[model samples]
Target: MTLDEFEDTPGDEAAPIDMLEDYFGARGWSCDRGGDDEIVAHVQGSWGKYELRGVWREEDRVLQFLAMPDIRVPDDKRATLYEAIGLVNEQLWLGHFELWANSGILLFRHAALLSGNDGPTLELDQAETLVEAAIDECERFYPVFQFVLWGGKSPREAIDAALIETQGEA
Candidate 1:
């Protein structure tokens, strides 16, 4: 998932909030926030075991399916988890998962499939396929994709910037 493999497109017009409102309303999901440039909705799915979060920013929209990992780490092993997550994140980034602001998005989705138990043996082809799926998803909801993709800078940079910005703001 190198930048060379990603099909980076220029940003488009902002997605209208009403479209998201309609989509969520049909599903009985209620809006949690209704700011001018952002909207968040909490949706309960049929399984009733997981909570879905739909976030809409001025230029992007994302529907994330949340789940807790099955394995729990001891307090001392937290660092190991952080390292593992970082490795996965880096692999994702290399696989066309662009870091925008504080978040990351895959332009194509097979990238996710590469994250196996090993967490370090991701192949480029798998990453490419994953990115393709993400692209297709983005096409189906271009406004949301654009908003999420373009709103943030790179994730790594954003975190550093946030720390500095917050320190200054404080």
Candidate 2:
């Protein structure tokens, strides 16, 4: 679900963040406070070390969800950074949808970043299809972040649109 679609209930302004924390904890995940209003959860799954960070800003009424591996890439291996980034991006997308569907919840404003220390790089951004038109924009530059604004009727549609955009770039 997108930030705007995450309804604010009565008498509970921070309910969203609390719900996320609870969800992760109930699954045997360890949660820690990252920044002032950010919660980071760590879970060791069969795939690898999963680190999910949720940043909530009450003042701005914004929330950001970030997922990546717990390990940091060494400076020397930066040459093959694309491989690492691809792994992270693929996992995040597959994991996010799986979790959301399992929990019967929607995720909006979904974006991803795939960076590489070497030359080749790719970025993917997508959102729910009903919420907005599909956007599959890419650049040859590194350090690119893909933005997917959620709140669509169907996540599949959004993903399809994004894929089309990605294909066009390629």
Candidate 3:
């Protein structure tokens, strides 16, 4: 659904996921329901595909989105990956990168505190920006991750190389 339709929804009568699914679908974005309280999508960016997972937390009155690349850090590179993620997160605005130790997964996560009397945030525009920014930042840092994981570049080198600004309208 459009943002207007979402805003018109009765806060207490329907779950956010219903509106979320429509919000994404109406934009020609793929949305997949992951169980009762989650929606998953692959957001394509210049760097690669980011798996964007939106999860609803009933107890906290919050909605969270995690955007992650398709690749995983190898067991041997986990330590370096952690350092790289720390460097990458230092410059981020909306979310931070994390390495899931048990699963060797890397993700950029952002959370939205629910508004109104019930359900998730009514600020769909902010939600869009959060998700888009997460994916964009993921793209910006992916090269550093690759350098650490397979190119044998030191954390500083990888981060510095990635940080080199290209002149253009951002």
Superposed by TM-score, candidate 1 places the C-alpha of residue 92 at a distance from the truth, in angstroms, of: 5.3
Q: What are the per-residue Cα lDDT tens digits for candidate 3 across 115-152?
A: 66553443556666767788788888888988888888
Query: Which ten-residue region of model 1 has the weakest summed lDDT?
Result: 105-114
What does the lDDT read for residue 128 in candidate 3?
Answer: 63
Ranking by lDDT: 3, 2, 1
What are the runs in model 3 whose C-alpha is more than 4 Å off?
1-15, 168-170
Ranking by TM-score: 3, 2, 1
TM-score of candidate 3 on Cα atoms, chains taken together: 0.84
**On a 0 to 1 TM-score scale, where does candidate 1 land against the true structure?**
0.30
Residue-level lDDT of model 1, residues 1-170, one tens digit each, is 22432324232112333333443454455665446433455433222222222233322233221221112334543433344344334434322222222222222222121122432222333323332343333333232222223433343443344234234544
Q: Count the backbone clashes (under 3 Å) in each candidate.
A: 18, 7, 2
Compute the lDDT of residue 28 as modeled in candidate 3: 66
Give the C-alpha miss distance for residue 164 in model 3, angstroms. 0.8
Give per-residue lDDT, candidate 1, residue 139: 35
* Between candidates 1 and 3, the lDDT winner: 3
